[model samples]
Target: MAWYATPGGLSSLSAPQLAAARRSYDLWSSGNPGLASKYSFDSYVEYAQQRHAESVAETAEQEED
Candidate 1:
């Protein structure tokens, strides 16, 4: 588990997780008004989690090859 320092306090999310969520927001937040309105931090966090899993799987595959 990784911890990050926030303005309020420490967050359970790692630096990479936070970075991924921010990138996810930047990609999706401004495109569709409807989607943007419905999207939230929780959604971004989910995306980040999926993205991390995919990345890990990809790396494992590459190592196997």
Candidate 2:
């Protein structure tokens, strides 16, 4: 029911979901030694937003059937 913007597009991630993404990204980056060299935090956030959008769309499509 809520929306936010990322470089990828508009996203439906709520504040809590976005917070979760941040935490997840932080954890993932800390755990992966090569992470910091490859991607910036902003890029990771964008990726999470895009992934969340795809997940929402896929779930909606499945439910419509």
Candidate 3:
């Protein structure tokens, strides 16, 4: 299953929360507007949280299986 489809992954984020996260990422990226550099601090943090949540959900599913 996709990361977003995983248990606890989709439910972990509400519609408003997802919109806010997207807005934050967009704002951060737009501020720099350089391809040479990577994501900003806020973007990195958001990505890390998303990755961590997905990983945790995947691990839980694996353990269940």
Candidate 4:
């Protein structure tokens, strides 16, 4: 029912979606620090890193099971 619940949606993401998202955000910020400053850079980076770590952990747990 939910978009993300769909098989296609789940399959659309690569194995390392969080890494990809982090890289994209980093690139954007590097190119436009002023625009990035419009956001809370420290909080954004912290959240991104936390989410990436969680994703990696979850993937590892899934593989173990």
RMSD of each: 6.4, 4.8, 8.0, 11.0
Report the number of the highest-TM-score candidate: 2
Error of 4 at 39 (Å): 5.2
Candidate 2: Cα lDDT at 24:
69
Task: Give residue 6's error in model 1 in angstroms.
Answer: 14
Question: Model 2, residue 61: what's the lDDT?
Answer: 100
| Cand. 3 TM to true fold | 0.44
TM-scores vs. true structure, each candidate? 0.48, 0.61, 0.44, 0.43
Q: Which candidate comes out best when scored by lDDT?
A: 2
Better of 2 and 3 by lDDT: 2
- What ranking of all candidate models by lDDT puts the best one first? 2, 1, 3, 4
Off by over 4 Å in 1: 1-11, 14-27
Worst 10 residues of 2 by lDDT: 1-10
What is the per-residue lDDT of model 1 for residues 6-62, given as tens digits with 9 covering 90 to 100?
221214566675776567576777776687788786665565556666777899999
Better of 1 and 4 by lDDT: 1
Q: CA lDDT of 44 in candidate 4?
A: 54
lDDT (C-alpha, whole model) for all candidates: 0.59, 0.66, 0.58, 0.57
User: Which has the higher TM-score value, candidate number 1 or candidate number 3?
Assistant: 1
Q: Predict model 4's lDDT versus the native.
A: 0.57
| TM-score, prediction 2 | 0.61
lDDT for 26 (candidate 4): 84
Higher-ranked by TM-score: 1 or 4:
1
